[model samples]
Target chain A: MAMIVDALSWVFLLTGGFLGVSGGIGILRFPDFFTRLHAAGVTDTLCAALILLGLMMQAGWGLVAVKLAFIILFLSFTGPVAAHALARAALHGGLMPLLHRAEDDPSKS
Target chain B: MRHIISLTLILAGFWLLLSGHFVPLLLGLGAVSILLVVAIALRMDAFDHENQPLHLTFRFTPYWVWLAGEIVKSNIEVVRCIWGPVSAISPTRIHLTATQRSDVGKVIYANSITLTPGTVAMRLEGDQIEVHALTRAAAASLQGGEMGRRVRELER
Candidate 1:
């Protein structure tokens, strides 16, 4: 059971690290500022969640695990709020996202 | 009244969890601090249903689980778009009608949309939310109304 927990923790940590790096690549690869928010969102939400969950698993059932859970809870709450604020600020600052209109795609009616 | 009680209990639990020291002196200090915080909150008129939201506790667990799954799914999609091709992402802005009755529910709906990668709820005015999706597929998924419906359920 201990070994299994350790294995699961490593899997989570590694996947989270990979996703975090993917988010970085996304920020560079995505065309515009608004699009980059999505990439950063990936790191804030799932990547953070995975890393914290992995740490919680390694900590096992204790106050340490409880504190980690609280961190996850707070991160999920604040991450999106911060993202929304950034997106809104950019929009209000007259930075228009390069949008793909439904008319632009001939395939969609 | 109920909100105050719930807030007190939550703060107490939070204090205990953070401190982890059961010594009488520390516990007494924790109690004093929690009471002080709660009193300040009450004075500030912050002990309301909207802020405390004790009613949502039972229902929130299931909603949170569902949201975590949605986040993971969208994360994978966004990651793919990152690695696959720049042309793969459409970057569309769409308007969504928030069907939730209360401010809390509407906020939850908007945040859940933003929480899922590949989409960000940019502007929320009254019953309408302006969202930017990384791809047309993400826009289509938000148009599905399933997540919005689930958030509405929490209000009831």
Candidate 2:
């Protein structure tokens, strides 16, 4: 059971790390600010949650687990609020999103 | 009265869990701090139904579970978009009408949109939320209004 738990923890940790790295790459490579925000927001919350979950599994039922759970709760609540505020601020600053065209704009194509 | 008791209990429990110290001095300090905070909150009139929202406890859990599932699903989708070709992303702006009656509901709706990965609630004016989605599909999903409806349900 111990070995299996360790292996699972490693798996979660590695996957979370991979997601974080890819999110970084996405932020750098994505075209505009809005798309990059998506990359950052998505991975920032989920990656932290996964990594903390892995740590919780390792810590067992104790103070560490409680702390990890609190961290997860805090991240889930604050992450979205911060993202919303950032996006709202950017919008107020007149940063227009790069929108895809379909049938509305005939002059472009 | 109930809100005050619940908040005090929660704060005390949080303090105990985090401090992990049973020393008399620390315990006395913790009690004093908690009381001070609660007194300040009472003065601020922050114990209203909307502020504490003890009524939503049972419903909020299931909503959180559902939101978590949606977050995970959207995270996978966004990850694929990141790894795939840049052209695969069809960025779009969408205007969604929030059906919730209260400010709390509207806030929850907007936060849920932002939490779902591919969509960010850019601006909220009255009942309408302007969102920037990473893909057309994501925009369409928001247009479906399932999240908005669920949040509206939470208000009741």
Candidate 3:
């Protein structure tokens, strides 16, 4: 059981690390303001979730796990909502849309 | 009502974890501390989130872990940008479109933008973010779509 838990932890840690890097890269290298928003949100939500989950497993059955779970839940709900608000603000303030590359524009109109 | 209890439990649990010992005195102290904090919270009227339960947190832990790495990476980038030769620096202003609708999300996005290397969220005027980046690469990073998409996913 301990080995299983340990393995699970490693998986979670590695995946979290990978996503964080991907998100950082995505935010750093993507093609527009809106695009960057997507990257940041992904990193905030998904990357955070994976990392906490690993901590929960290592914590085992206890308040530690519960607290970790609480954090994850809070992030999941709050992360996107915060992102949404930020994005909307950016759009309304007349930030540049990827005129040539926005797949969302045609869909919105 | 429920939120109060929930908050108490959370506080107690946290207190215990931090204390890491279970003598009668410690346990009594933990309970008292939890009560005091919860009382203060009540006085502050932090009731809305008191009822918040742990929900779907496990689902995104991995992503958060990865975010830590990004923070670290960005830290390096920021240091290099600020400390490198002045000739390597290029001050720029860029506007990125926003696609979110919640205040919390907006703050997080803004903070994250500032947290990353080479960028500062100078203004969040409506939908456009007036950002200042130390370099073109930093400016371009603001243009990326991944952050926007990820934030949207979290909203869902």
- Top TM-score model: 1
- Name the lDDT value of residue B149 in candidate 3: 60
Error of 2 at A3 (Å): 3.7
Q: Candidate 1: list runs displaced more than 4 Å.
A: A102-109, B46-51
For candidate 2, the docking band is medium
Docking class of 1: medium
- Could you give candidate 2's per-residue lDDT for residues A52-95 as a string of tens digits? 98998899889989999999988888998999899888877877
TM-score of each: 0.94, 0.91, 0.51
> In model 2, which regions exceed 4 Å deviation?
A102-109, B46-50
List where candidate 3 sits over 4 angstroms from the true fold.
A1-109, B1-6, B46-60, B125-128
The candidate maximizing lDDT is 1
Worst 10 residues of 1 chain B by lDDT: B46-55
TM-score of chain A of each: 0.90, 0.89, 0.86
Give fnat (model 2). Answer: 0.76
